[model samples]
Target: MTAINLAKDGLWKNNPALVQLLGLCPLLATSNSFATSLGLGLTTLAVLTLSNFTISLVRGLLDEETRLPVQILVIATFVTLADLSLQYWFFDMHQRIGLFVALIVTNCTLLGRAEAFASKNPIISSTFDGLMMGTGFLLVLLLMGTIREVAGNGTLFTNLHLLTGTPDMSIQLADSGFLLLALPPGAFLTLGCLIACKNVIDGALR
Candidate 1:
């Protein structure tokens, strides 16, 4: 297969979050705000890319027996780096996300690739897989974040200070936010609607 096929598989056809439904715990739990989702999504991207690279490098040395443990170790290492970086740089966002940020190490998408794709693939391919898969994950996170933020708070990018802006504040939306969208039930309902919409669009294209 060509590079394009790999891209298609990772980005749209076989995304960890949207297609395979992996890593829903963090996906659903922390996507109430655009900042939170973007922060987590980027961190997950870094972990997935780094873990994929490391796993591909060691694929030849390990057997199936030792690979899973080794893969987790690799993922954990990068996740720690991501976690500390967030703590040091974006301390507030780190505090807001709490343990969920560190838990990206345990996310199945990272391990799934280790066992399913990265373990057998070359480094270059594994890297591409990680990047595209992470992009897919980030895309879903951003979509959910947009819906949640707009619906919950009637704003798109409210808390810019967490990254690089003023503290204790945000640009308020002119209209009243839908309080229901901020709730847990709202997340489930919105996600279900998103999936249904995607399916309908796919069906229409077909």
Candidate 2:
């Protein structure tokens, strides 16, 4: 596929979070705030890109029977490194999302890309695919996080210092917001609305 089509596919047509719905665990569990979602998004992006590139590098030598196990190992390695980096540098944010961070190993999105695209494509194309897919996932996380934070916490980017170590970036709109939106049910509601909106947009575009 051409670069443009590949990008469109990963970002919208085959979005991991919005359309394919591969990583909803983290999406729903850790997306209560923008900071948490952004941290997880970046971590996923880094791991996804590295895993795809690495897997593409070794695809030629692996047998069919060992491919899945080898891909898991590759993805796990990057996830571990990402987890460690967050724990060491962004310790506060790490504390908040550490569980979900570890859960990235089980996220079918990474495995799906590794098996479906990276294992069969050139290194460059695989890398691009990973980047686009990760970006798409990140965008969805940001959207959900933004909605939850604003509706639930009455803040858009509260506690952003946990990720950037900058105090002035936080915003507060109200003393107490709709607390329910910060919970699991809110995640589902927001996501469903997002999916519906996407479908509507798709229909309009068509």
lDDT for each candidate structure:
0.84, 0.93
The parts of candidate 1 lying over 4 Å away from their true place are 165-170
- For model 1, state the Cα shift of residue 28 in Å: 0.6
Clashes of 1: 0
The CA-based lDDT of model 1 is what?
Answer: 0.84
**How would you encode candidate 2's per-residue C-alpha lDDT over 83-120 as one tens digit per residue?**
99998899988888999999999989999999999999
Cα-based RMSD of the predictions, in order? 1.7, 0.9
Which clashing pairs does model 1 show? none
Best by lDDT: 2
Where is model 1 poorest over a 10-residue stretch in terms of lDDT? 165-174
